[model samples]
Each structure stands twice: as C-alpha cells, then as structure tokens.
Target: MYSQSHFVKALELLILLVVYLAYGSSYRSSSLYLYVTISIWFLVFCWLFAPFVFNPSCFEWHKTVDDWIDWWKWMGNRGGIDLAPEQSWEAWWMSEHEHLKNATIHSLLLEFILSLRFLIYQYGIVYHLHVVHGNKSFMVYALSWLVIAIARVTKGCFIGEREVCHEASNCVPHPQGHRLSCPHRFTVPSVRCF
Candidate 1:
C-alpha cells in the first residue's frame, strides 16, 4: 500500500499536471498566465500548509509530545496551572522521546520549505516581468515583494507562528526566543530534543 507522503506527492504532481496540460498551450504566452499559476499555487497554500503544520497525527509527534504532557498532568498538577519540576521533566522527556526528534525536525523542515511561497512567488513575478514584459521595473517588483515579505514575517511571528513554534518547540530551537508563543509546556532548555 502507498504511504501518506506518496499520496501527497502524487496529488501535488497531479494538480500541477492537470493545470499545466489544461492551460499550458493556451496561456503559454499570455500576460494572464501568471493568474492561472497563482490560482493553483494559492490552492497549495490553502490546502497543504495548515494540515501539515497543525495536524499532529500526520507526523505522530503528538504521541511523543503527549506522552510527556500526560505524565505531567497525571502527577496532580493542573493542566494550565503548572509545569512542575521543569528541569527534570525536560530531561526525562528528552531521554524517552529522543528517537522521535527526527520526525519533528522533518515536519518542521517540510513546513519551512512549503511556506517559502513568498520567495517563490516573487521570483515568479520577476521572471514573468523580465522575460515577458521586459520593462525596467525590476526594482519596483523587488521592493514590492520585499515589503510583502516583511509583512509576512511580522504576521508569522505575531499571528500563526505560535502554533507552529509550539509544534516544533521540543525538536527545534527558535531564534525568536519565547516571544513566539511557544508555551513552556512544550519547550525545554535544550537546543535539540536529544
């Protein structure tokens, strides 16, 4: 039987193939070509990222993370009140859940790659303009996408970064510090889970 990654990769290829074949010849040289491309690409942002980032079962890191969480709660501490004996808890989890660290890292890596749509999207625009339109607005597009990327970064940290940071908190060390909203429940003092 095929695995989930196989199915997902097949679906991505199938979508690209169908979009390319159906419109490739007709829109090959049109200004609106980017429109069709962006539309399909937007579908990826909507469909793939959220599920991969939030759905714990996909990577099964939930089981590993939850093992510590369950143990923490059963020790008579409140769910949201306290994370007792933080140091020992962190160490024990690292020793026990170390094997799954790679899985969490892989999940985070996939997220980083997929969520790089801003760079990819900007490059697409620049390529389109230079090759197709060929006007001297390179700086304009560059600045435009730069500004957009800035907004994206701000939005990520303030808005959605919390969930993702939390998800990878145990396995990945973030430079943004704890400001990204990774609850102390998931984070330990180590750089990596191991």
Candidate 2:
C-alpha cells in the first residue's frame, strides 16, 4: 500500500503530466520543437514518479559533491550519524539508505517545482517564438533553443545543490553551522521569479 505522501506526490506528477499533454496538443500546429519539449518534460515527470511507483524502498543513495576535480572518499560521505540498530553491516547500510531515500524524495519534490517553471518557459517561450508571432527566422530558433538549454542545465544544478544541502544540514556535526549547511534561498523556486 502506498503511503499518503506517495499518493500526494503521484497525484502532483499526474496533474503536471496532464497539463503538459493538454497544452502541447492544443497549441498551434504540431510543431516538432513543442512536442519534443513536452516529451522531454513528460519523461522528467515519469522519472520523478518511477521511484515511488516501482520500488519505493530501493532508491540508491546519491550525494552531491562540491568539488568534482579534487574528489576524495570523504567527498561521498556526508558525516551523518545513522542511528539504526547495529545488528550487522547490512543494517548500517539500510539505515543510511533509508535516510538518503527520504531526503531524495524531498529534494525531488523541490526540483519538480522548479521544473514547473521551466515547463512554462519551455512551452510559452517556444510557442511565442515559433507560432504566435509566426517569425520562423533562424535567429528565433537559435534563441529559443538557447533559453531552453540554459533552463534545463540551471535546473539540474539547483537540484544537485539542494540534495547536497539536505545531506549536509542533516549531518551529525551539522557541518559549518546551520546557516552554511541549510539549502540556500534558491531552493525555493518562487524566489527565482524575481
């Protein structure tokens, strides 16, 4: 049986998928760009939902590393104390695994919020450029693609940072004090509106 949280998350994703599909179909003409964008967005939506739908208990833990080039074994360790019963090695792993899974679910939700904004920019900007104004100039196409690429890349970075912040803030030592460990204001997608 799915928990209430899982239901809520699935419902939210379903709503988004419906909205994107409806908008894509109703929008002017069957433009390849619009459909492709929606398809990609839909895949993202599915990716977010797959964990909850398929195997809620088996999500692999992933930590965000700040330094890619100067990586170390410590880079993967978040320094969080796992309080699970010390029965065996498997127990220890499972304890940390569960913590990571919960954190990932929360971070994924935040990312979904940002993805919504990106969806708006993706469909709205593309529609306006490719269809509404009827300006099929190469410059317009290039600009649309550019904005779309930026939004996608920036969204990934924001989500990764959030996951890192989530792990750090929950660490036993509370790395670098609360202010330093807690996620930045950017995690809140509403702030991006400004």
Candidate 3:
C-alpha cells in the first residue's frame, strides 16, 4: 500500500539509521557507546515521534507563524503590512502539521549526521594544529580552535533558545523593533561587536 513517496522516505530513514548505528558502535568504551546509542535514539524519537505525539496540529500552526514572523522580524519589521496576510486557520493548521512531520525526519538525518561529521573534522583539525605542530604553530593553531569553538558554542546556544521559543509560543515582542528581538539577548552582553 506504500506510495512512491512513502517508499523513498522510508529508504532514506533506513539508510540514515544504519549509518548512525555503524558510527555509534565503533566507539570502544561501554559508557561512550551507551551515550551514543541513547543520543541517537533520542534524536530519532524527536525527528519521528515528536510531530505526532506532541500536538501535531498546534505545533504546525505555531511553526508556520514562527517561520513567517521570524523572516518578517529579520527584515527590520518594516514590512509588517505585507506580512499580515490573513490565512485560513484550518488549511494553515494541516499544512503546518505536515511540514513539521517532514521537518522532524529531515532534521534528524541532516543535523545529526552533519554535526557528527563537523565534530570529527574539528577534532582532526585540533590534533593537527596542536599535537602535530611545535611551539609557535601550536599556540597559534590552539588559539584559532579556541575562538572557533567559542563562536560555535555561542551560536548553538542562541539557536537552541530561539527554537525553544518557537515551540513554546511565548516569544517576546520587542518594542524597539523586530531586529531588537534577536536571539543575541541570550548571549553575553559584553561581547557586542558594535
């Protein structure tokens, strides 16, 4: 009874799951292996079960508005009128739900696989830059890694917060402007670039 689209989706999911399992089991330590297994399971659940199990209809509507508002807000909140087109709640509701369901699956493969790949590359870079180099080069390379790591961590945290707000429906409306509502608020105030 599976349609072509369904078969394609299922095949993609199976392939990703196999790859993750292979990578996960290559770890030697029991604790690390267990952690990896749990992490993968949690990610799969989030990408598969979350859409249906956690208020599919509402989540979809919320996500649609969230995306539109986020884009509108990014454009200095100037085109408010253009962004205010009335949408059919029911149609929006169904579309949002379907979008969320697909997003969950897509994100699982994209985010988890890419994050793992990046981490591997980062570790290799750090090893080559510090461990393989002598004095001067080591210090320079280590500092570069430190700066990049800090930037990545800071960006990741802010993105996480914004995602939480998108899911929770309690995003604060800034009086100054939409740009003012940027996730930079979650980051340290002292680090402003000006």
Candidate 4:
C-alpha cells in the first residue's frame, strides 16, 4: 500500500506530467526537431533511472574514481567506523537499490524533485510560446527547443542526477571500510513528447 506522502507525491507528478504534455502539444513543432526532443527526453529518463536498474556501473561510474574527499575520510577514519554489525550483501544491496530508486524518482516522485525546475520550465515556457503568444516562427521554435535542451542536460544530467549519485556513493563504505561495489546501467525506446 502506498503511504500518504507517496500518494501525494504521485498526484503532484501526474499533474505536472499532464501540464507539460499539454504545453508541448499546444503548437505543432517541426517534425524533425520534435523527434529530436523526444529522443533527448528518453535519454533524460534513462539517465535518471539507470543506476537502480544496474549496479550503478553506468551513471554511478564516478564512484569508482578515487576522490580526495573519500580517500581522506577513509584514511583518517573519520566516519569510517560503524559499530553496528555490517549489513549482509543482499540486505545492503536491497537498501541501496531502494534508496537510489527513491532519490532518482521514487521511481516517479521524490527523485523527480531534482527535475522539478525543468518540468516547470517546460510547461511554462512551452505554454507561453505555443499557446499564450502563439509563436509559430521557425526561429521561435528553434529558440524554445534550445532552452529545453539546455535545461534538460544541465538539470537532469548534472544537478538532479548528481544528488542521487552522491547518495548512492555514500552507501559504498558504510558499516565497514571495504567498499561495496555495484556494477552497470542500461537503457531504450521512445518517440513522442511533442
């Protein structure tokens, strides 16, 4: 059963999805450009949800790299010791999986908070351009698409995604200094957003 908070979050997400789709469909964009945007949107989906499907091998690749922050913490024994029993591999993996799932999207909501701004921009800007102002010029279409592309990459790829990845990484050496490893991420189809 879904908790009250989960139900509320799910409702908010549904509303946002409807609004974004409405704005995007308000005016017919150029077919080719529309296709491209749809593709990028799928990529955005893949990027957000990749780690949980696999062991973070793809999106979580950053963890494999040695960072001075992590190195220092491990070496100095600062926050390295967990007196509680080390969790089993199965239990630890399951917990990490669920945490990443929630952070990335709660499979659909909490994680989507990372992309909340982008969603707002999409619905607001698209509606303003396509419906409110009725901007149908090729130049206007191009500019609007550019704005969305930038927002998608910057917000989804960098900002929102990094938050989940950071949370994913923190679980690595927990309850013991020996880092737990998760391997891989993968992706796929789409074609309609506008």
| Top lDDT model | 1
lDDT string for model 4 (92-166, tens) is 334445556545434567556766866665556655644537765667656767977876766554333323434
Between candidates 1 and 2, the lDDT winner: 1
Q: Can you rank all candidates by TM-score, best first?
A: 1, 3, 2, 4
Candidate 3 lDDT, 1-194, residue by residue in tens: 12233443444455555655554454646787678667765665555555456666645887878867864554443222123323333233344345446577777677578558555645544553344464455575678679888888887665454455455443554564233243545422222222
lDDT of 2 by residue, 1-194 (tens): 23234554556556655555656456546687577766766665665676556764444343223323224433344333443333333344445456546577778787678668656755655564345477657676678779778887787664454455545544222343333323343222111311
| Reference-based lDDT, each prediction | 0.54, 0.52, 0.52, 0.48
How many clashing pairs does model 3 include?
A: 0
The residue pairs that clash in candidate 2, if any, are none
**Is 3 or 4 the stronger prediction by TM-score?**
3
Q: Give the TM-score of each candidate.
A: 0.27, 0.25, 0.25, 0.23
Record all residue pairs in model 3 with backbone atoms less than 3 Å apart, i.e. clashing.
none
Per-model C-alpha RMSD: 14.0, 16.1, 15.2, 19.4
TM-score computed on alpha carbons, candidate 1: 0.27
Candidate number with greatest TM-score: 1
What value of lDDT does candidate 3 attain over all alpha carbons? 0.52
Model 2 alpha-carbon drift over 4 Å, by segment: 1-132, 166-179, 182-194
Q: What number of backbone clashes does candidate 4 have, counting pairs of residues 3 or more apart or in separate chains?
A: 2
Clashes of each: 0, 0, 0, 2
